[model samples]
Target chain A: MTVTRSKAASIRAARRDRWAQRLVQCGLHAGLMAWGALAVYPLVWVLLTSLKYTRELYADPFGLPKHWKWSNYQEAWVYAKMGTYFLNSVLLTVGSLILVLFLASTAAFALARFEFRLKGLVWGYILFGFLIPHSILLVPLAIFTRQIGLYNRLGGLALVYAAVGIPWNVFFLRAFMETIPKELEEAAIMDGAGMWSVFWRVILPLSQPALATMATFHILSAWSEYILALVLTGTTVSRTLPVGISLLEGHFTSNEPGVAAGMAITIVPVVLAFAFLQRYVIKGITAGALKG
Target chain B: MRRGRKRGTSWYGSPVGIFLFVFPAVGVYTALMLYPSLLSLYYSVLEWEGGPISAAPFVGLANFRQMLSDPIVPLALLNNGRRLFLDWAFMLPVALTLAFVLSRLRRGASVYRFLFYIPVILPATTMALLWRFILSGNDYGVLNSLLRMVGRGEWVRPWLSGDGYVQWSTSFPASWQHVGFYMVIFLAALVGIPEEYYEAASIDGASGWQQLLHVTLPNIRGVYVSCMILTLQGALGAFIYPLLMTKGGPMHLSETLISYSLYLLWQKKTWGYGSAVATLSFLLGIIAVALVWRFGRQRESALYR
Candidate 1:
């Protein structure tokens, strides 16, 4: 009778344990769901606000609009002068990306596979860029640019972006590249592959994830940059999206509903781009973090 | 291996020689980044309003002298300090907790991480503008509308328009925008902790909290330090939020050193004084980084063995 009672007690204990696990799991899901809502709600709200007419915007900031104003994006694109801004941002992003990728990849390759004197000093020099805030460097960067003919030119701004990007790019890419097996390069060398060929054929292909990671970060920084672009761009021709959108603030006079609409318009291309490349972006982040 | 040795015959013939072949990059780095930083230091010693065709007179520490005497300098420093503390208070624990919860899920973790990180891809101007609308004083604004529905009508006010609330009000949006980036960083670090450590602790009959303390916290020390440095630099460089949201204020209450300096440079054209401000910011940043590095290294070495 005692043995039968013990077996029954064990069964009851196991059931209780199962109940506790289920409760914990449920609580975790509930918490994550609340956080997820908090995260996505702001983005969704802005999208809905963008679709509202001005009357609806003023009358009800939180309510859904009776009619969708898809034309708001059209207005922002043309009348708000975002097309010019978009082109300028694209040029900047492309220019900076090309410059950074070339310089960073070259530097990273050399640093990873080569041994040299003053290597520690070289590494320290690169990391030193992180010590000062860009704000501190801006005054000097401006002066230096003015001294050169490139101060207000697109070429000069790209150079500045590339300079700032090189250190971190080299650091991150070097970390990843170091993990690549040395045997592959040795095998390539045995087949009479020159250093340039090896770098192009072997190293480049393997470093795609790292390169993608750098490209994502550089694009974001270049696209949304304000202070440097603001100070440097002297005309509508060179003004990027951030500065262009900022001018809308003056046009609206704190008619925040319009400003919200404008921002939502500005974000559409970037969001779409990210959405399409979502897989690569996740791969970029996870891989980037590991090396970093 | 034979190729490596053969290529080393000439000083500039090896793969390593390609490393020093970066003289062009080095030149650009020096001319663009290093020289400007040094020149700013020189300008900090001068006394002149920016003029297109005139020389700046040497002022020999006058800028430093003036910097010490200025009351606004201390205010900016304290403002940055408050932001760093507040960001740590809100972002660090919140990110850790969220990441912990997310890690346990069987599905949707990647999707959730992506959604949370979406705001980061938005322009800072967008974030600044979006929060401005949400936090606006009128009942039509989202927060106030929600407050009204809850019958807390007294809680709504012109958050950015008054001196009493300007500082705290501006910081909220700034913190909101940055929390995601750091959250990702912390999540990455948390995910790096080996599952074996937890399993070992469980076998030893450790509770959940005990495992967290004994296993999780120790592994993420490097990330914590790096996060602290990044957060500190970001707080000190605080410009976009104040610039877009408050234009440095209802009464310059939201002005940081960078904002004040940029106003001098871009608007007022007080170039010499602005460089002084820039120099002060640089010195403070270096010192802050050094302190954090020292503290972090000491903690790390002590924690090992």
Candidate 2:
């Protein structure tokens, strides 16, 4: 009789544990759903508002529009001259990005592959640059650029971008290149490849993933930079999309729809690009951070 | 150091080869970067308002004295304090909690991680614009509308405008936007913890909560310290968001140290005084870096040495 009673007690405890587990699981799902809604709500509101006319947007701010205004997108696009800004942005961003990658890669390769006197000293100097806030350089760089007659010029800004990017980029690429097998380089050299040839053919191709990672980061930074653009360029055509988008705030007083449309116009292409390239971007950023 | 590679051709030893290897980097650093940094220090002591260098008058410590007396300096510092507090309050815990939850999920974790990371990849301009609309005072704002439907009508207010609820209003959206990014970083740290440690703790009859306290916290302490340092530095130099959303006001309430300094130099053309603020910012940055280095060393000694 005592043995049977103990068996019943064990069964009851097991059931209680099962129920507790179920309760916890249910709570977890509810919490995640709430968090996800919080995340998605803002973007959804922007999208829906962008599709609504100004009249409907104000009249029923929270309601779905009876008629969607597809032309709003086109209007925002043309008003901002975002098309021209987009082209300019692409040119400048790509130019700066290429310069950053080439300089950073070569520097990183030298630091990683060669051993020399004061190598540690050079590494320390490069690393220290990362700690200096970029904002501190703004005023100084502006004056310097103006004095040199390079102010308001894209080529000038590209040089500045390369300067800022090279430090962190070299640090990151150096760490990555450090992991590449020395045997691969040795094998290439034995087959009569010179240092330049080995670097161009073997090492460069091998480091494509790191290069892509750096390029994507540079693109993201350069494409969205506003302060530098605001300070450097004066002309509307020369100004990039970020500054152009800021001006959208001035258009249409208390016009929520217009602002939303403007936001959507700038957002969609970038969001779509992010959506596609996000995996690589995440890997790259995380890898860079971890390597640090 | 490999034995077989010792006698290989010394391409780097040639004079032209050495120049090819090193000159480009050194040339860019010296002319474009280092020279300007030094020149800024020189310009700081001068009375010139961004004029040609030759026309400037020397005014030693006058700019520094003005910075000390400026009311905008304190106001901006106070604003930075608020930003730093709010960032620590919201971004830190929310990120840790998200990492914890995301780590436990069995399926679709990568998709969710990618979803959260999208904002991180967006240009800061787009991200700022995205939030500017989302937090606008309109009843159509997703946040305000949700509050209304939930019958919290009294809670809705102009987020980026007006003196009412100024502090909480601006910070919430800013924190919410960046939480995903910090969460991803924390998640990376979390994932690096080996699973066998957790299993061993469980086998030893430690409960999940206890194990987390004992094992997980200790393991991630280094990450926590480093991230905190990064976030603090980012907060100290906070700009773009407040500049875009409020232009640092209903009454200059949101203007940060960096933003105020930028205004001084660019808007008012008080270039000399602005350089003083920049100098202060640089000093603060150095202090932050020193603290991080010290903390890293202490933690390394505790954990590994």
Candidate 3:
């Protein structure tokens, strides 16, 4: 009878523990959900606001659009010249991605595999690039670009983007390449492959995922970059989306809904990229943290 | 193995191959970033108005001296310091706590992670614009409207326009955007901790909070330092948020050093003065990074010992 009483008391204690755990779990969920709502609500609010007529927006800032004005996107694209700006952004993004990939990968390949003089010094030099504030470089870069006759050119902006991105790119890619087995390169060399061939056939293939991650990151950064684009490009023909949207903001001061539409147009591609390639994006960013 | 050894020396290990592979990146990086940085040091002393380099008059140490005495410089630096402090005080703890909470959960963590990281994917400009609308000074603004809904309308003030509030208001969007970024960083650090440590703590009859205090915090010291450095650098170089949202308005109260420097260069056309500001910003950044590195190294060594 005493044993039975002890078991009953122990079971009651277990039940209490279970209840406490449940309560904690519910609290965690609540906190996370609230934060999640805060993270996403503004974008949703802006999107809905973009759909509403300007009058409706002022009248009911919090309300859903009475009529979905899909034409706002049209207006933003056609009339506001967001299309040209979008194209410019795409051009610069792709151009920089290509440059970064080619340069960083090849450089990383050599640094990862080869023995060379000043290797440590070179590594330090490149690593220091990560710390140098880009703002400090802005004045000189502007002057240098004009001196080189590349001022007001999207290509010049792309070149700058590529250069700024190279440090991190090489850092990440070199780390990734180090994980590739030395045996693979050795075997390729045994098959009479040159350094270029070995890198192309062995290293590049194995580094594709890392390459993709780096590419995604670079593209996102380049696409969203404003200050450099703002400083570099002077004309509508050369202005990227961020610059265009910023200019749009200035032009459409009173037209909140129209401006919001333009903002939405600027955001959609990035949001969609995040939606689809979230895994890569998260992996890329976290990889950066892990390395640090 | 023998053939591989010979072949490596013949082609793959040639110095020319290495040179060819590394040169393009080194050249471009030097031309665009390195050279320009060095040039800024040269330009900082010159009294030029964005003119040709040959025509500019060299005024050694004057620009730097002037910057040191400028009242606006101190204000900008103070604002940056305040922003950095707020980021560390609020952002670091919230992110760490949220990460810890997510790490403890058994399910749906990825969903929460994705949701939280949504703001991070948005451009800085978009974030600035969105917050501008939300924190708009007028009654039509979201925050003001909500204040009225809760019968606390009197508390509402011009967030981005008010002198007292503009700095905080401008800094908020950046903080909001990056909280998730640091959360992810902390989460990665937490996930990296060996499960055995937690198990051992549990076996010793330690509670959840005790385990975290003893096991988790000590293990992630390096990452914490890195996050701090990143936050400091970001705060120092803050430009987009102020540029897009407030334009460093209400008497330049919200302006960061970078924004002010840009204003000097682009708007005011004070090229030499702007270079001075940029140089100071760079110097301060270096100092901050060096301090963090020393601190982080010390902590790491102490922890190991």
Structural similarity to truth (TM-score) of each candidate: 0.92, 0.90, 0.96
lDDT of model 3 at position A121: 83
Q: Which 10-residue span in candidate 1 chain A carries the lowest summed lDDT?
A: A283-292
- Residue pairs in steric clash, candidate 3? none
Q: Please tell me which model should have the higher lDDT, number 1 or number 3.
A: 3
The reply for model 3, stretches above 4 Å from the true place, is A1-12, B1-9
Residue A37 lDDT (model 3): 97
Give native contacts recovered, as a fraction, per prediction: 0.39, 0.31, 0.66
Where model 1 places Cα greater than 4 Å from the true spot, the runs are: A1-12, A254-257, A276-292, B1-21, B138-140
Q: Give the alpha carbon lDDT tens digit for every residue of B35-89 in model 3.
A: 9898888888999786677998999999989987888888888778877987899
Model 3, position B22, has a per-residue lDDT of: 89
Candidate 2 C-alpha lDDT tens digits along A164-243: 77788888788888889999988877776655666667778888888887887787778777887878777766777787
Q: Return the lDDT, model 3, position A283.
A: 89
Model 1 CAPRI rating: acceptable
C-alpha local distance difference test of each model: 0.76, 0.73, 0.87
Model 1, A49-97: lDDT tens digits are 8788877877777788789877777767777777788888889889989
DockQ: the better of candidates 2 and 3: 3
lDDT of 1 at A144: 65
Residues B1-305, candidate 1: write the lDDT tens digits. Answer: 23333342343237445754455566666677777777778888888687652488898998888978987777666667767787899876777777777777667787777776777778888788777777777656667777877899888777878776767777767776666676677677778888999999999999999998988888877777877887778888887887888877666787777877777777778788878887787787788888998999888888784
Give lDDT tens digits, candidate 3, residues A1-292.
Answer: 9999999999999999999999999999998999999899878987998898988987888889999998888888888899999999999999989998999999999999888998888888888898778888888887789889878898888889989998999999999999998898877766777777788878999999999899888877887898888888888989998888888866677788888888888888988887887788878868877776
Which model scores highest in TM-score? 3
